[model samples]
Target: MLIEQILKTKGGDVTIIKADHTLAEAARILDEARIGAVVAMNGDQLAGVLSERDILRQVARHGAYALQMTVENSMTRGVITATPQETIDQCLGRMTDRRIRHLPVLRDGRLAGIISIGDLVKWKIEEHKAEADAMAEYIKGG
Candidate 1:
């Protein structure tokens, strides 16, 4: 399935945080939203992404001081993004290769939505089930 189709089902609402925002603020947003990552923005431009892992790493390295750091300092820059036209399998491969769990989806060079490794895995399982059902029905001559 295409990334666009997934977005259509999931809706393209991405939680964003400013680059200048503190990591503590980003953590609050993530906690309140029950999400794994947030897109860091710089005046409407995509700056990078900040995830739970990034925050945890910072905390491990600098203790409580990490929370005071700017989102830009904790975020993963030069992010590897996915296009709406890409297939789930393609995106999954890229994520696996990069060892990333989240991918920001872009449309026309603008942030559209985000996809998680869990989402792709769920769809893959659903697709397999659908195919198995179809084959079973075919065998039953229905």
Candidate 2:
């Protein structure tokens, strides 16, 4: 399945935060949204990505006060992006190779959507099940 298809299913609305937003505010947004990451936007531009991992990393290294720092300070800049045309398998491989759990999807130079490793895994599992079911039905004659 294509990433675009997944986005269509998952709803591509992206949650965004400003680069200047404090880590505390970022955490609040993440928690409130029940999401793992948020796109850090610099006005209309994609600045970076601030994930739970990023916050934890900073707090671990700098203690709780890290929350006072700007999201840009802890965010993973120059984020690796996935295009809408890529296959789930391809994106899965890239995410695995990079040891990342979340990926932002960019298409037509715009912020499209975000994909989590969980999403890819779920879609893959669903695809496998459908394939198995189809084979079973074929064996039964049809």
- Best candidate according to lDDT: 1
Please give the CA lDDT of all the candidate structures.
0.95, 0.93
Show pairs that collide, candidate 1. none
Q: TM-scores, in order shown? A: 0.97, 0.97
Candidate 2 stretches greater than 4 Å from native: none
Error of 2 at 118 (Å): 0.6
lDDT of 2 by residue, 31-134 (tens): 99999999999876789999999999999999999999999888998899999999999999999999998899999878899999999999999999999999
What is the C-alpha lDDT profile of model 1 across 1-142, one tens digit per residue?
A: 9999999999899999999999999999999999999999888788999999999999999999999999999899999999999999999999999999999999999999999999999999999999999999999996
- Least lDDT summed over 10 consecutive residues: which range in candidate 2? 41-50
